[model samples]
Target: MTEFPEGIESGFAAARQIADAVLLEGYVLYPYRASAAKNRLRWQFGVLVPPEYTAQGGEHSHQRTECVMEARQDDRLAVELRFLRVQRRTVERATATGGFEPVERLELADRVLVEWDEAVEERIEILVPVEELMGEGVQQGFRLPGVGETELLREDGTAVGRLVRRREQVDGVVRLKAEELPGPYRAQRLTAVVENASTWIPRRRTPREEALPRALVSAHLLLGLEHGRFLSVTDPPEWARPAVERCRNEQTWPVLAGPDDGCKVILSSPIILEDHPKVAPESLGTLYDATEIDEILALRTAALTDEEKREARGTDARAGAVIDLAESMPPEVLERLHGAIRGLREISAGTPDGEQPWWDPGNDPAVDPERDEVLVDGHAVAAGSRVLLRPGRRRTDAQDLFLAGRTGVVEAVLHDVDGSVHLAVTVEDDPGADLWRAQGRFRYFQPDEVTPLEES
Candidate 1:
């Protein structure tokens, strides 16, 4: 085990908060009960099964993360790997001979305990100086031994039931290495490979649940720098863009995390996330299902029947906390969850008295969408211009593929507040072109995503 450098913990407070959510992102769903079919099939992201499982075409047995950083030879890098360890909890009833016998469920005076496979969070941290990584690099192996425990259930000194918990052994290795970039800037590329090197071998066609005990669930990495700053692999600078693109990340993507621009910390997750992802302040607590919105889940949790809530409480402690949170939430908190508006600012100066605010285009007299023109392929593409849509490869939406090679008439050439130009066009083949024109609705695209038709 490697000790983290001083101030590492406090410096990564915000990033850790988001990473915690990632660890338990899909641990459970809205219903939050063990019996839920969705809950039964768990650990969707960052699952590293045994090598034997991978050999049989199961999930990969390793995650590789490669990222860049601006650093000096003396700078230090710290890697923290986090994941979940599955623990099987079985309930047993007291036998007539004063012994306990395994059972599916155990009924107590006030509550019921059911057999469930729970998860225990685990983490491993290691630190290394950049100079060392730049030289020979480092490889560290870690192991978590299996554990078993039994708790006797007694009411007023009379035995009723018992709970047995067992955890399987898990082992892995973390390899860290760095290379100095060839550019003029002082930068280095850090490579980390986390592999499940456990000795457990799967039986022929073993089920996922049977192999999960030896697996790493929702595994992710939180990387920090002591005296250097990590670059955004998703949005690197022009000089570093080539290096960023050259970086290879397997089974995970690295993004900026932590407060204020996310330069100090990088969170490598199996689930894709935008740079500087934050846990919304309006969120009351973790629901263990990040796919669903917090408001909807909170409302749905509140609407659960008493029986369902009871089962949820028995399912997991985290689920019980969610139920309690929803039931006791104040009116104001619920209202806050209803909706939220962000990024609004006061209108800037030099606006007409009755004109629309600066947020709207009408406030700027010099800007005219219909009259504006953008140069595309040496031709002015403006209103009434026919062009073939050549959607960019990096277009955000997959539906853009459906519009590939389609023809459209430019309705307006618009400029956003961010200074980016957008061509608003109506599809020539769309039957609702007239209705779209009347409603002032148009599809917008960048200049590079369209080619001028030259009046053909």
Candidate 2:
């Protein structure tokens, strides 16, 4: 005979044996936890033995045949068996659940159920046809046509039976019973295979080095009055010098005092470095004091880092815009404009002065008229009416003082039909009136020198 391939020859032989065993005795292979960490197998059965075979001495032969058939049934059996071995080893070495127990049997119609409860909290059950077990036994010589439903009670109240049939209406069903069985059955334990594989790996942490306290203490000691005052590090005034020294020496402290009453502080770190300082007494003068100290500390910390110095310089440049506006405006105008600009700058980066030009309504021509007439929107002028005009330079101060001071000359007089005389007045500058410093047209001047300007 030509040499057959080993794999093909073996497969054919295994299939032949399985067919023969099935024809004589029925067996059903059921899978358990094939996808689980612990692979497991189960066999359900229904087998029959011909009466003539039962009479012969062939029981052992049939038993061997059935075992061989089972061994060769599936290609995955080897892998399944290996998985089972690993699972068993894991269970045996586990800190939890490890032991074994007695087997139990149940019979119904054409099927038989075999079950065992192990000490490791596992229950294993198998169902096989009654005919398979009987045929195997008879083929090896024990004489009975087949196994049949016959009850055998255990020492405990639990019961057991065996059954066999060639063909019956109840071919597939097998029922099993056991009480107070330890669990975490073969089905349950095998589930760990997938769960373990899917678990997340934890991240490792870096080891931390100890901080040098002596260097920190030295830097703190060098902290000066100016630095301490701004950052609000008011440590008995005496401690100020030491704190700055400590900051300087250690090179790790990320913040220092601002220029105010030392209550404000600035972060030295790159992330928040370019932002403005946080100070308690807020104002240009107070902030200037705090920032000066902050800059000194920043200079020491940023000595080797050009990037940090650049960030600090940028912050200083932006802050200068606000200072320029303050110096240019009058005190009263500065106070009001600062209030408004402070709110605006919070919503935008640039100063309000740079955002728009200053325009005062007092300088608008529409609202002001010539001397001797009333003007409406700068379009029409009405003569002989008591009107207010912006005075010329020479008499502006006196005029303003007269209006504000409520004492001045009647530069011209107008008699109305109602007999109410309106006086046009000019007032000269008084040495005593510091308030009347600036000159204007609507202001009072000398009554004797009054010269009326014609309405245009």
- Give the best candidate by TM-score: 1
Q: Backbone clashes per model, in order?
A: 0, 66
Candidate 2 segments exceeding 4 Å error = 1-281, 284-340, 343-367, 372-456
lDDT of 1: 0.87
Q: How much RMSD separates candidate 1 from the native structure?
A: 7.0
lDDT tens digits by residue: candidate 2, 1-456:
223334333432333222222221101110111121221221111111121222231211011000001111111111000001000110001112332223333333322233311011111112222223222221111111212232233324433322121211111111211111123321100000000111112223311111100001001101111111122222323423343233221111223322331322222221122223332222332112221342332223324233322322222232223233333444554343233333433234344655321233234343322344422345322223333444344653553533443333333343343434334444434353334423322343332223334345
Over the stretch 1-456, how does candidate 1's per-residue lDDT look in tens digits? 577776556557778888999899888887998888888778888999888899674699999999999876577888899999999999999999989899876666545678888899999998878788876789999999999999888988999988899999999999999988896898888999999999887788778888889999999999999878889887898999999999999999999997776487889999999899988889978888877888888889999998888888877788889999999988889889887897888657555666656477665787899898889989988899999999887988778778999999999989888889999989997999999999998887999999899774
Candidate 2 lDDT at 422 equals: 39
Cα lDDT, all candidates: 0.87, 0.24
Weakest ten-residue segment in model 1 by summed lDDT: 349-358
Candidate 2 Cα deviation (angstroms), residue 16 = 97
